[model samples]
Target chain A: MEFLSYTFMRRALLAGNMVGVIAPLVGVFLNLRRLSLIGHTLSHVALAGVALGLFLGFFPVYTAIIVSILAALAIEKLRRDYRDYAELSLAIILAAGLGLATILISASRQSAGIHSYLFGSISLVGTRDIYMILPLALVIIAVILKYYYGFFYLAFNENEAWLAGVPVRTLNVVFMVIVSVTVALAIRVVGTLLIASLITIPVAAGMQVAWSFKSTIWLSLFFSLTAVNLGLILSFYYNLAPGGTIILAGVVILLLVLLVKKIWLLLRRDL
Target chain B: MSFLKVEGVSFAYRKERVVDDVNLELKQGDFAAFIGPNGSGKSTLLKLILGYLTPTRGEITLKGQPVAEIMDWTRVGYISQQVKDFNQSFPATVREIVGSNLYSKMGLVKFLNQELEKKIYRALELVEMEDLINRKIGNLSGGQQQRVFIARLMVNDPELILLDEPLAGVDIRAQDDFYRIIGNINQEMNKTVIMVSHDIQVISKHANKIVCFEDGRAYPHCSQEFSYDDYIHDLRRTNLRIIPRHDH
Candidate 1:
């Protein structure tokens, strides 16, 4: 309770909670499309953006969002070009992002400045981050709700969805943008390396017990929120890294869900 | 104008022309099966109609407008070749797959109403899949999975249905059920269909006409006019083999 009174803790918790809800919400579609690594790739791109922003003496978050969205679009384009090698397209972007980030990081010589973005620091999440994260989270939630069916269809099959007039091209672009925005905002909470887990691991857990697409969405949301909040609270008490805690929580939950599913199947077999 | 028309359409992939000066016409409720040996471009023709690949020359119009510009996509349902490579562990249920196709109509509003639910059920019932509506689509047999997709198509009640090798990987036993459902869609629902199949012999039973592609040229004939010897001769003339469906 006393920890909640700290300004930095409050900001970190607020921003982290929003990400907990929306990142996994978006990840369900990403997992279906098998673009789960885009979060990690774009987080690396955001690091480069942060480096550029600091070099130019501008706000890093703004550049991070812009750069991430651009990279997301590039990933989408490359994906279409290499339709058969969709994962190869991601690997290309990841390599490019890492190379660019490494170069820019060394050029700026702001080694210490980049530390918080790499693995996350709750004390570094400012009031501005909360304000930005909160509204973006709400907008993403609303948009996802509005276009839920279209996303599911596209995720299931892109070419069929296009012919059926799901605005496949537009929706694909929009979804990539949404994912990039979420990743950019989430980096502050879970850091560049761990945000991918925030988006994917809860989804992995949800699929273990899901009966349908709707159930998968609900179950993933539940596990995601649980992991992020629990991770944040534990990090606060133990003075541990928030990003590590959130990701570890997600991994643990996925394993537990898998174990439970195994036990339940065994029980059914015995019965 | 016909229900669907492919007028002077020709398409090329990079250096090679895949579809050449192919023209086709279908009235409402006509079942035309595209049959040909491998590399003859039957699937390419289907792609043209779906506007997945635009013609390098000429036009493809559905209901009088270019297919790419057709405003009401719900009027057309498609089961693509990718259905063969379907992710068997996909976590969606039959109901979601069927109902999600009606998304264009459910625009702006987020929830599915009673009417929408009824349509989904009716679609499932038409495919004899209503009992398994809540079942995960991945858990269904190949034939049942095909029916679920058909039900997904039927939910929109589209006028024109395009199926490109819908039974490509389906077990031989389940294939009979697949044809029965397609038969119902054609006869009872009176929907126009364009199906690409390797077995001209089997599909000729259902198709009113057979459009055979030989060396990028299309030859349309009445189903009764099709001869096995003629088809084999056409393949020989083009220096092509009588390709089995699985031979790429």
Candidate 2:
């Protein structure tokens, strides 16, 4: 309860919970579309952006988000060329991103306590970060609501969706940008390395019992929100990194769900 | 006079042309099936018609307009050969799958009204999948999945239906039933249907027109000509089987 009084902890919770709602919200489509790993790739791209921002003396977080968004649009365009072997584009982008990040890190030499972005620090999430996160999170939710079936159909079967006049290309670009911005902002709540876990594991856990797309979303949101809050609270008292603890909480829930499903099946067979 | 036309459509992959210098035409209410051996470019031609690939050298038109210029594809329904690409573990029910087709029209402004719900059920009933509306799509058999897809297409009541290898993994009886449903759709609805298929025998029964692809060329035939050729081919195949007569 004393932790709630701290401004930094409260900001982390607010930002983390907003991320908790969106990471898996976009994740359900990503996993269904088999683009779950794109989150990780874009986060690496975010690293390059952060390095650029550091070298240029601008706010790193803002630069990272803008850079990753541009990278998303580029990836979407490249994705069109390498349709069957779409991962080729991802590999190319990842290499370029990492290469840029390494060079910038070397040239800038501003590596002073940079683990905050690499891992995530509650104290780093300022009032301005909340302003940025809240609006972005709302936009993601609103887009999902507006084009709910379009996104679902694209995930279910993209070519048919194209014929069904779902505006697949436009939706794809919109989706990629959403994922990019999510991964970029999520770096502050969970780290660049661990962000995909928030987008993947909770959805995986939800899919165990989710019978419909709606159920999948609801179940995933439930697991994610719980894990994120639990991780924030646990980290506060136990002195652990919030990102690691949050992802670990998600992983634990996934494992427990698997265990319970297996036991339930076994018991039913016995009857 | 034609509902769809392809003139000198020479489509190539890289430097190698697949559908080369092809000319094809279909009248209104015609069910044209493309049939040929593997790598004969029937599928590529279908993709060209679907505006997926631009021809290296010619023109394709639907209803007097080039497919490239036709922006609104709502009147067109397609079921691709990549049904296998449907993630077997995706958490979508049959109702959701069929109902989602109406989203392009109803997504922004409307919820599931009674008319849309009825439309979904009617499409399902047309494909004999009404009872499984709530069932998860992944749990269905291959044949059942195809039926669900057909139902998905039927929800829109499109004027044009394109299917690529629609019966790849379906069972024998189900294949027959599939043809019946498609035949009914063709005759009763008066919709234009074009399909790429390996099952020439079954297709011949339903298709009013047959276009054979071979060696980067297309040869169009009326049902009368195709039936005669199919009979000769079947006879030759049966005669050749005499050299290795067995339970097979």
Candidate 3:
């Protein structure tokens, strides 16, 4: 109970739940567009940005946001340049990001913090981290809601969206920018390694029974928040790593949902 | 003035011209069907009219305004033949799919008002899909999905509707239903329709104008003015009989 009152624990919870909500929200669109791997690639780029920022003495999260946005634009350019080989863009950038991160981590004497960036430590989240993450989560949520119809159209059928005069090129750039921002903020809470799990696991679970697009989105957010909250509380009491615990919680819930759906189908058959 | 015009239009992929120096004109209420063998650039020409591809040589105009300068895109609706290209597992309801039409024409600011909701219902009613608004799009049959797409295109009330092989994979009964709906749109609603189809007999039965493409060149003819036998012979002679030429 005392741990709940601690500022570090409170901050971690706030940041975790925010990422919990925003990751899956953006993730639903990414999954629909078949761009889930881009999230993993951009997180590696964010890791490189964090290492570079720590080495050069800049705010790591903000530097990550800039680096991620640049990397996203490069990915977009490469995708255009090699339309048939779009996945190659993710592969190339991921390799470069890991190489740069390794070099920067070796150069910096304050490399102890790099451990937190890799696996994530709730104790590492501070007041400054809260301030940075809050605004980004809000902005992403706002944009997703405001341009909900346009983004849905783009995800469903990009060519049709273009024919409808939906400014597809500009909207695509905006979507990547949102992804970059989410990746930057999420790494601070979930770490670079497990961030993809947080983004996609809940979405996968929600998709098991969600019959409509709107329900899928809402159910994904519900599953995400449930996982994060349960994971945070259990980890605090059991002395387990929050990031892995949160992801595992999401996985457990997904398995349970699948089991329940199967049972329901069998019961209906008997009736 | 013509409702839509494509003049001296040409498109190429690295020096191999697909659509070459094509000219076409459509007026309000015109039911024009573009017929060609595979690689004859029928779909390419339709893309040019929708501004999906810019012609390498000449220009296209909509209502006396250049295609590039037209701000009122709601005046045109395009249904691509790439319906099979859509992800089958994508989650959306019929209402959501139909509602997406408002985004391109209305932009980001206007929220879904009562007027837009009513418009969507009216469009779905036109396609006779008003009852399935809440059904999952993926669960629907192919014909039903195609009708939903038509409703999606109609939500904006466009004057010129361009469809590329809309009935390609649909069953014969559904194809008949589609032709009837399109015919009603042209004759009753007085909207111009330019459809690309390989089903020569069905299209010739309904279309007032028939345009044939051969060797990257387009030959437009009034349905009453051209000889079907000559066209079939021309199509067979060029080794362009990919889809089995329909004979009268």
The alpha-carbon RMSD values of the candidates against the true structure, listed in the order shown, are 3.2, 3.8, 2.2
Preferred candidate (DockQ higher): 1 or 2: 1
Candidate 2: give the clashing pairs. none
CAPRI-style quality class for the chain A–B interface of candidate 1: medium
DockQ of 2: 0.55
DockQ per candidate, 2 decimals: 0.63, 0.55, 0.58
Off by over 4 Å in 2: A83-85, A88-92, A95-110, B5-27, B53-68, B107-114, B211-248
In order of the candidates, what TM-score does chain B achieve?
A: 0.89, 0.87, 0.90
* Model 3 RMSD vs true structure: 2.2
lDDT of model 3 at position B69: 77
lDDT of 2 by residue, A1-271 (tens): 9899999999999999999999999999999999987887898899888888888888888889999999999888888887887798888888899899889877886766457878877878999889999999999988888888889989998877777677888999999989998988898889877888999999999999898889999999999999999999999999999999999999999999999999999999999
The order of the candidates by DockQ, greatest first, is: 1, 3, 2
Model 3 C-alpha lDDT per residue in residues B186-230, reported as the tens digit of each score = 899999999998877789999999998877899899455556665
**DockQ score for model 3, please?**
0.58
Selected candidate, larger TM-score, 1 vs 2: 1
DockQ of structure 1:
0.63
